[model samples]
Target: MKNWLNLTAVAASVALLVGCTNNPYTGEQQAGKVGVYGGLGAVAGAAIGAATSSKKDRTKGALIGAAVGGAAAGGYGAYVDNQEAKLRQTLLNSGVQVQRDGDNLILIMPGNITFASSSANITSSFHPTLDSLVLVFKEFNKNGINIVGHTDNTGSLQLNQNLSNHRALSVANYLTTKGIAGSRISAYGVGPNQPIASNANEAGRAQNRRVEITLLPPQQ
Candidate 1:
């Protein structure tokens, strides 16, 4: 599987570069109207791995690959590019970290702003940020949304796992209320298993405790 991904990545990279064109209006570089459309195809082509190595992330890459077939390569890139731009604008100063990884988009909501300490309940102040995301989800309904929950290693494994699960579920349910179909969403908890920063310090732990919503564009 890894070897196949590597080969696919190489081929996709070539396709992406060849498919790209200069932005005529802004004189900026951008991917073509169509680019490599595969779950890990563009990610691999861009040399970026899936969001994180969590248990729930195991099938994320494959599902995204299968969801977006190669047929939608061109328009898929363009769609995601527009969505990413909108997300960056909406999330500006909203305390959510918006990033474009490869051809994919990730919104990282820190534990500090998302939830109170040792709780899965979202803070009242976080609602506006979510509202902005809901608008995007409704506008761009074709993307597959994956909500992954994570936490620090301070708590027991089981406790942390359950908290993570609840946190993910909370976000998923909230999105549903805003009209995003439940079918287009999947939630998972990684507990303390996948920390992006050190768990040894307060600042690092704060960074580690986060919920990542990865928007995977449909090939179409």
Candidate 2:
């Protein structure tokens, strides 16, 4: 049964990726969302699939469409718009960067403020930020969160991978304790596989070692 469930999860994810539309403006396949939700390990993907497979509260199809940063349309799009506005207003001046690329909402939390050097333990001071964030999650209640962990290429692949997963788990666990449903959250450690900056310098490395929590609309 477990194996069957895993297979179903992979199949569902693949179908979602393959069915994505192309954004004419950017020329990049909306399949790029696979990099966000699909790249999570099998365990995480299976958990998400199992939790969301029967959920019908939100329209998952809203996330499937053409256009990077394009306006969301229909009911699902309106749902996303309201969530985005709530996040922007709540997180204002909070140091966390909130961005909307395409249909997804990304919350970029920098490593310097979130974790200690080379450690997955969140800093003591970061709790308040998370506490505030959890309130928003409770208020929204219709979206699922994908927590992605990243690291600079300063360490071995295995080490970085472990660190990244641990960091993401830390955030997920903390949020669960603060009231976000565990089933609504999925965590993955991507390590250095995806970096937004150069790893050769301290500044860039700091930028690279970050956690991204993407709020996803409910899946069908």
Give the winner by lDDT: 1
Per-candidate TM-score against the hidden true structure: 0.70, 0.66
Clashing pairs in 2: 69-102
- Model 2's TM-score against the true structure: 0.66
After the best TM-score superposition of candidate 2, give how far the Cα of residue 139 lies from its true spot, in angstroms.
0.9
Clash totals for all candidate models: 5, 1
Model 2 has an lDDT value of 0.74
lDDT of 1 by residue, 1-220 (tens): 4643564455566556755768878998876645544323455422323333344553454334433443345456668778887998899988888887766789999989999988989898999889889999999989889999999999699999999999999999999998899999999999999999999999999998999999886741
lDDT of model 2 at position 4: 41
Poorest lDDT segment (10 consecutive residues) of candidate 1: 44-53
CA shift of 161, model 2, Å: 0.8
Cα lDDT tens digits, model 2, 1-220, are 4544545445446545544657768977775344333333333434444455444511231222212112222335556657877888888877799999766799999999999999899998988888889998998888889999999999799999999999999999999988789999999999999999999899999899999999987771
